[model samples]
Target: FDLVELHRSNRATPPGIVLDPFAERALSPADRGGDRREPPDETSGATASRGGSGARHDRLVALDCSWETAERLVEDFAGVHRSLPFLVAGNPVSYGTPFRLNTVEAFAGALCILGERDSAERLLSKFTWGHTFLELNEEPLARYADCADSTEVLAVQDDYLAEE
Candidate 1:
């Protein structure tokens, strides 16, 4: 599918962009920092409003669901936004977290959106927060090693570890 250029422009790429673990790139011992996912904080642009521009912040709907649920979201996005691109952001647990109130009908609705199924898959594939958590906890010594340079590591140890 030819990407809608405007929609493509509106995409908010996940902050910590990382290559898939099983992707073509060769794994290196230096994979720690590369795989860590940091929590989202206020963006620089958001903090720079010295004066009001009168532009309202867009609404973001956060939810938990599975692949089926994601498909439904795509449908809604396309239906509501036939021209403009809408951004959808969520962690993997947003889907299939049974404790939440989601419905199969909603999932089906998402799938009904033409071409949205692929978009949903791509969205899920690009989001790696869940994967980052797994790598960090499961391999304590190696997580974030990919991101830490020698100076940063020293600073971290001195500042954070010294008290411990």
Candidate 2:
């Protein structure tokens, strides 16, 4: 979890990870890219802004800050981007809402969709509400992870969206 320091603060990445304080690569917002509609090619580019084929441990960056500060934290990165697929937010601030995850929840969701369910759980375990988030989103997270391509992921998201 390479959390680039956008400001002077005391936040730290979770234990036992790459936890680099500054990462050179910048990522775009997950929802900004049509690029995610296609599978990520085997390189770091617009399509891989979210977790793509190129989303190796080194490439993964955690924008660990409040959503209010995320804009300054994530300025105009030159790339395509896309949001995490459909899932309810379980954090106390936005429980049961869609796309309202905190830093840990957001990273955990990305991990789950990228086929790292166990790892995602481990990440969320750092928080007290982690299990609640999983309880609310486990099914969709698994479903999104199983999707082979972004097109399929969007299709599944449509199904969940219809429920709203």
Candidate 3:
């Protein structure tokens, strides 16, 4: 929760502050496979989802940067990496779009997926369009939060993708 790391380097992509291989690289269940949603490999169970226990730790990290840089800096980060399931973006720039959330929205969506709806709402309260995000993603967010793990989350996501 506290700001633990902030490296001010002369280089453009400094260490610690920016991150995310997961958020940028993650594809929807349907996107990962053709028509059928493939489950993650056996080795990925722990990192797949934070569903069952909810609070793995008090801290939640949200990475903000270009996709180009994110891919490069991904290995620099360390933690339980989990991707948010598909949710509609409510930010003005990418409104109604999927997988285009800004940093705050991404943070909120992660919080929602982690089963902390009230905390997520509080975090989103700072922005005007934030409420709209919750409104747009309410159903999926709730379903995702209730999932037992990534497999269940993927099943729920496949249902949404089927509607599109």
Q: Ranking under lDDT, best-scoring first?
A: 3, 2, 1
User: Which lDDT tens digits does candidate 1 get at residues 1-164?
Assistant: 22111122112321211111112322222222223233332110001111122221111122233545443433222101111001122234444332232222122112212113343343334435433322322222232133234344334334433453
Error of 3 at 87 (Å): 1.0
RMSD of 3: 8.9
RMSD, every candidate, angstroms: 17.6, 9.0, 8.9
Model 3 segments more than 4 A misplaced:
1-56
Worst 10 residues of 3 by lDDT: 40-49
Greater lDDT among 2 and 3 belongs to: 3
Enumerate residue pairs that collide in model 2.
30-82, 30-83, 31-82, 31-83, 33-81
Top model number, lDDT = 3
- The alpha-carbon root-mean-square deviation between model 2 and the true structure, to one decimal in Å, is 9.0
Order the candidates by TM-score, highest first — what do you get? Answer: 3, 2, 1
Predicted candidate 2 versus true structure: per-residue lDDT over 7-121, tens digit per residue: 2222222111111112232122232223334322121111112333432232333455566665554432222234566668898889988867766676677666655577677
Provide the lDDT at 105 for model 2. 74
lDDT of 1 at 125: 41
- In candidate 1, stretches whose alpha carbon ends up further than 4 angstroms from where it belongs are 1-96, 99-115, 129-164
